[model samples]
Target chain A: MSASPGVWLAAIFTLAIYSFLYGDNPVYKFSEHLFVGLGAAHMAVMGWESMFNRAWTPLYTKGEWWWSGAIIGGIMLLTRWFRPIQWISRIPLGFMMGVAAGLSARSAIDSQFWRQIQSTVTMKLNTTNNIVYVVIVVCTLAYFLFAFNEKSGLGQGIKGVGLVGQYMMMIAFGASLGSTIMARLSLVIGRLDFLFKTWLGVLK
Target chain B: MKILRSSVPIWLGVFGGSIVLLAMFIKIPVHVGLWSKWFLEWRVILASFALTLGAGNLLRIHANRIRMKREAWMYSYVTIVALIGYTVLGILFKRTHPVYSFIFDNAYSPLSATVFSINAFYISSACYRAFRARNGHAAVLLLSGVIVMLGSVGIGYAIWPGFNTMTQWIMNYPNSAAMRGMNIGAALGIIGVSLRVIFGLERGHLGGE
Candidate 1:
């Protein structure tokens, strides 16, 4: 047992959530729901503070009342619950999605498309590695060319290249999956350490 | 009504999206050459408020459950109480409030971490079942995986001095090439989707009448 109430709460919640591994029960459900409620409430609190600082502060201190338009638009999101006025919700959703799309698309084009092609073409060192990289990239890109029928001779060649590309991808994915296991294992160890060391004080 | 249902939203998206898109290219010194700066802030402001949507939905769902006396309605009541309680404490005392921080530090932290860490057990079980080399491709993949995993740890380095070099070569050349190809394709896909949304073709996001 821990003297600190915070540690007790932490340990209890940790055990309760882990209890789900054994089987679903009321304790796990309580912990799960409690998490959801608390998480959302926390977000709301943070959002309110942020809005006050970013939107309201400017309007109050800097005399920029136009900032209120963003707040009003944001409040329209709650109209999602209203049946007749639900269409209004789309207004804000439209704004959010559009802004997000624009931001991502611009960055994606420059970073993902242009920058990658740029780097691949500029491989001036390590001649063997460069050639291998160029070949792998071209072949892997051929994997996405599904517009042509693979029954033709040229298409078959492309398909073969794509097959090699798939193998390369599988190798990468295997390394990724292996690393993912290790990462999750670290999380488990951290939690177990908290349980043993922090909660129970049984481990150094 | 048709205009309100679809056309309005589409144009709104295009208008909002175009603001940022154009800002990226064209430099307008409006508002002391900082209109774009404020527009970016507006984006954050808008998104912050949208965060409330999840809480709103949760409230309605659990409220309905409690109203109907559904199974485990007591849990729903617990959820509502927790939500209201935390929101009030958080709002009045700010996030740094001792009670709010206590709940977050203790309840939310442990619960979320435990939830995520629980995936480890299932993932290891899955790896055991999935890592079998039933074919040439599978064998190659598994071999690469084993080499990389072994090379990453001290024990494998102790066992074989070649593991690190082998893993580095595989990761740098073949893996990098493959990932670059996927990234380019995915970026093109993103541009395509963005254009669709801007053009009002991707109205699935808008739901229906």
Candidate 2:
């Protein structure tokens, strides 16, 4: 019922995608491929924009020659397709990976490892709930200890704690699953709202 | 050839990783801090290039499929045409152009949303089949999942006020505890692997022996 061409196109595309629910068909296949194409093109465009702004502009306009190294590395990355000079691509890959590794390692140690431990240890167990929370945290951590022998007395205690931890984890996973379902359903609702209200003009 | 293929890359990895890592602990030398910052920016540029390369790979695969006239080859033509056409439109007029925005808003956004929304149906079907309470653990999982799912929506509060309270308790205590424990373990694993990669002990990324 929408008069706009854009709305009409969107409805058609949405319908085309949803057609897969009925089973694989030509419309769904076409839409799937088209989606891939558009997605890839969008990525390429963003990449080009980044290269132009970050590397090209600085290298040419600002005369920052160091950025030229990035440009070279970017170009070198394309050599991955060529079997003869594919090894040349490793340099950029290595550089990128190293940077990623370094950043991740630093943040993981600082935020996840040290900060998490500090917070866990420093939590005040004044209330019953707080005490239960602390105990659950300890139990959860115990569950991850794979080095203990199950036959030993210490291991038996750990195993009992770990079972409680396992149950807590299951409950957590359930909550997570429930949250994901709700989120996905919200998207579905949004699409349905668009189809009915925007496209069909059925709802006020 | 050996150096280019192996040794040089390993050395570059070490240099790149070490400079960034060292800069975190060492703030005295101004140049080291500057280089570390520059390296991070360079990574963005490199990642952009990687994205473009991925697009190129997509093009190659589709073009090859079309040439070979394989199964569902007609779809390949659709992909190729859309990819080339959209890329040209975006490059020529830039992203802010009305035509580009129209295509993105109408085609891309709707398509993406619909694709994700489709998962709702599949997930519901899966839950119906898999959410049977076979044991105490299973019963707890099912009950928690049901409570949370109901409490999140308007109908659950209407049904029972206690649902919301129970949902909050499960999320605050057990959920938080489990996630924190998992996060700690994962962090340690990440640190170990990252250190290995930085030191060139992990050569999997280099591709092939």
On lDDT, the candidate that comes out on top is 2
For each of the candidates, the C-alpha root-mean-square deviation to the true structure, in angstroms, is: 2.3, 1.8
DockQ of each: 0.70, 0.76
Model 2 Cα lDDT, one tens digit per residue, B9-121: 77788888888888889988888888888899999999998998888888899888988988999899889999999999998999999999999999999999999999999
Model 1: lDDT equals 0.82
Runs in model 2 deviating more than 4 A are A148-157
Interface RMSD for each candidate model? Answer: 1.6, 1.3
Candidate 2 per-residue lDDT, tens place, A74-158, comes to 8899898899998899999998889889999989988999998898888888988778788877878888888989999999999
Query: Tens digit of lDDT per residue, candidate 1, span B67-103?
Result: 9999888898778888889989988888888877777
DockQ for candidate 1: 0.70
